[model samples]
Target: MNLVPGSEGGFAALHAWAIATAAVVAAGCALVGTLLVVRRMSLLGDAISHAVLPGIVLAVLAGGRPGGFAVLGGAVVAAVVTVLLVQALRSEGGVAEDAGTGVVFTTLFAVGVVLASALARRIDLDPSCVLYGVLEFVPFDTVAVAGLEVPRAFLTGVVVLGLVGAGLAATWKDQVFAAFDAEAARAVGVPVAAVTTGLLAATALVTVASFEAVGAILVVAMLVVPAAAAELLVRRLAWMAVVAVVLGVAAACLGYMAAYRLDTSAAGMIAVVLGLEYAVAAIVAPEDGVLARGAARARLAWRVRCEDLLARLWRADEARAGPPAATGPGDWAAAAWLRVSGRIVRDGDRWGLTAPGRAEAETVVRSHRLWEAWLGRHVELPLDHLHPPAEWIEHHLGADVRRRIEAEVGGEESDPHGRAIPRERGRPNA
Candidate 1:
């Protein structure tokens, strides 16, 4: 097929079918991947993918065709075996977790490879086909259901994805508790082992279904990257799952289009795009992402330092103290910015706060002192220890928490160091 850019006028149906197929596969991978990432068992997903080959080959040899129940059964058995062997090695041989997983899955994969090679003449199985299924040709395979022809692979992916989705929804709470604190979940009789086993089996099924469209190795990318990206974007599990599903589906559609445009493999394109999504999330996500919170904190710290410097400048002018001592680098930069903003003026080499700057400066000092007073009453830290923590926290504390602290402390007049606390809004009554 000659690749073309943009959606052609007649390709709407094709695009819809492709995107629907991709979404089904993406959802399955993301759902399973969420649990894998939460449990820190990502390698287990890899193991199951590799080990399913022999079972699939054996099932085919036993007269089961692709997308048949026999193939799913064989894959499930293979997945369970891989998990059991890894557990046994870890418990008995004292092997490290990764090493045990590596040893078990590689051994099973090797066994499958040998069996498939020996039986190649008698079987229709291809090693390359086992590694990567022909997803592009999936729409060609049709079955009559209710007198209507439907893509068999699409139907299979939907059924399997639905089952996984239902199981996850039903066990959502238990899964969350187990993932957050396995020991606590076990103590509460949450059937942690059963949950883990069920998750692994579902992962195996998802991998099998997706293998036709996404291939074996690339399925790992679908399973981990979206969920991992969502984790960066959200804190709550439900939100994380929701975000992950959306991201996965979007990536699936966009990747397929990109691959078609570039005359590339759809599976490879989706994996590459998913990796890109994760990288973007890592850079731009708030709170924990590399760029977001870091930049926010940097800006906030600079603001605080500037305010402090302005306040110090005002006090220096009032007390007839020479120039304020050189402040920290961030504070110095903030001071320069503040001066440029017309909130401060440079008188010779020394800086002085403008009237507007003095007001802003007072608000910062008031927040700091109120926090110190609150801490002195509520926390048992020493006088000097109180300042450092309050310095960071004073920025985040809202007016409501300040009022609550004031009420708790009976409206203290002075902080631990006997410094008169600044009033809110420069009002004496405050």
Candidate 2:
């Protein structure tokens, strides 16, 4: 079996193998990336992805097959060297971590570019191979597996994914502890340093495995984007890892199909798709997404506006005066909603609370005046300042809290302003 453009069956197999390879490698990257992002070592992953190129080229030159265990070992060694060089610069030379990282990775990556270009014929690597991978050509390179011809890139991706997944699972608790509190974890004998070394090694392995399929830069995108999006969608580390792997694989499959349809770079399309997934996650995430937060704010504002309207009407009723005119946008909206709910009625250019509304209004006024009394008793603020705090807090007080505050305020009938404090409905005054 030959994989050539002229054969329809070969082209179909090529597409399937390419997508499968991308998905498996993306999963590996996502798993390692979850830890890296949580530990705030995402920059380290990016550096390793680019910096391993010279080591890989050297290993291949030394007769180690590309995507083999020897190549993986070389990559891990290169990644460790990159981290050590960065740390040395930071500790010994008094350089900042970010600055040291910038210097080390860029220098090493540049050296790799030169080596790969200089020995292009020997290593079969070109300039494009350094940045954009040869994913579309993956099926052309095959190895026999159990009487079946399998694409070597896909096999490499599966092996790396399994190794990374198993390593992370076996050390998940330590990883979580170190991610959140490295100093405390180390003090408690969690082997944070070994865990960190293993993580870096895993990053290097995943990066090298995906190198032939998605290149250096796009692999970084695969490593960071899905994990970041998953973090936004979940709070637990285990759940986050699962979601990240799913998102990464979905992005890989969708991106490959899109690239095939559009006749574009598959690696580039995969990165773009990952970006889109992150944007969507940011907008619609479960608890703290932009839309969810906005809706929560709106609901709180609505409750405050309506409660203020009711309290104002109650005060007017007490004074035996007409309701205050609704002038502001907030007042008008609250007024319309109250009238619709039968909490208020239009009486010839004025408003008045119904019987049920009056009871609820009394509760609001009680909470407000009780808070004002408490503030006046404990806080040294002037009368005017007390009103501001009570006005802001009145809507949040519940019956139990109000009862507690009423007792704490020593059953004061009048606030510091000398206004009559409304009693809680159905409760006898002391």
Candidate 3:
């Protein structure tokens, strides 16, 4: 179907084709990238993307079309060769993996650059296209399919995505097991080597597919950035892949629009958008994100302060003394919160626990004293050392655990400090 009403003359059609092509390529990259990031082979993905340039230029010189299957075959061969050379360097020459990768990919990329530059007039491939890509011109290169014109790059992306996605789906279990623990997977008879090689082949395929839309350099960003962000946002590998694909596609669409409005490189802008997405994930991700973790810590601190305030009030009531002085900002805030919550009320110049507050306060005191008794019985700590540990542990104990500790401590009525351990509000002394 025609994307725009006037297919031949519509600039909107061209823009649509370009953006769609970018999104499809981004999806493919993201799928493979999830595995790469999880396996800690992201740098290898970068190496393969750059190293595949020579293979592509060689294929183009041999009369293969830019986005054709022949070029993809050549790129896969190059990627396999890159991985082999890196392994050989590490095993035979005792070179570090990172250094070997750096040496191999840079050397191969320079060769590709030289080949492209030297044969610019002879081959149909452009050096500029290999470096930065020509996504804007992608729509102009059309192939007739099903009695309709489709951009060749888009067709190539769709084919690669289907193949990669199918391959991953078929072997996802093995891939995941190998990714998290290769030794264990191998001991369990999983094909770790085959899984790794298959992943490398998929990475090469996606890299070549993205090469036309995002080029050699920026394709690394599409490959790793979205996957890394997804890692921050989600816990499961499958969910990570899904989130990465969504993030990549969104960046491609939004970046293409932004680039069109600003007259900039679509690939570069797409990478920028991916970076922004990663930043947002780092800040707002549910479990480990900056905001979520900060909020959790704040809540823990607040609960501790509130419980400490209640315990202080209970102790004052036990001593028949005035309420403890509010010591600092945290104490003042806790006092105000207690008052608002009706846990405490102003008793002339100081705060006193209300009936409901008294019940809760007894619970805290019960936990504190019970723990102190348990520690005094079991641990060899001095009486003075017991209070600090009990103070920290009071918020964590539950009713059942408090009872178990009470039983284990031989039903002690008072702690080692001679302070009476408060009973559960309704329970009689054992």
Q: Please list the C-alpha lDDT of all candidates, in the order they appear.
A: 0.81, 0.89, 0.93
Per-residue accuracy of model 3 over 278-381 as CA lDDT, tens digit each: 99999999998999999999999999999899989889888999888888999999889999999999988878889989988888888999999998888899
Tens-place lDDT per residue, model 2, 1-430, is: 2324576885777788888899999999999999999999999999999899888888887877666667888888999999999999988999999889999999999998998888878876667867889888888888999998998888989999999999999999999999999999999999999999999999999999999899887889999999999999999999999999999999999898889778999999999999999999999998878899899999999998898899999999888888777769989888899999999998777888898789889888888899989988998997778887789989999989988988898888888888888877887877
Instruction: Score residue 296 of candidate 2 by CA lDDT.
Output: 95
lDDT of 1 by residue, 1-430 (tens): 2234475744555555666777898998898899899889888998888888888889889998666556878888999999998999999999998999989888888988888899999887666656666666666666787997666767778988999999999999999999999999999899999999999999999887787777667888888999999999999889988888888998988888898788878888898899999999999998789998889888876766776687677657656898678746777777778988989988888777787887776666667778888888878888888888777776666667766776777778778888766656634544
Two-way lDDT contest, 2 vs 3, winner: 3
Model 2: which residue pairs collide?
Answer: none
On TM-score, who's better, 1 or 3?
3
Stretches off by above 4 angstroms in model 3 are 1-9, 377-380, 425-430
Best by TM-score: 2
Range of the 10 consecutive residues with the lowest summed lDDT in candidate 2: 1-10
User: How do all models score by TM-score?
Assistant: 0.80, 0.93, 0.92
Off by over 4 Å in 2: 1-7, 347-349, 425-430
> Any runs in candidate 1 off by more than 4 Å, and if so which?
1-19, 325-430
Total colliding residue pairs, candidate 3: 0
Query: What lDDT is obtained when candidate 3 is compared to the true structure?
Result: 0.93
**Native-referenced Cα lDDT, model 1:** 0.81
- Give all candidate RMSDs, comma-separated: 4.8, 2.7, 2.7
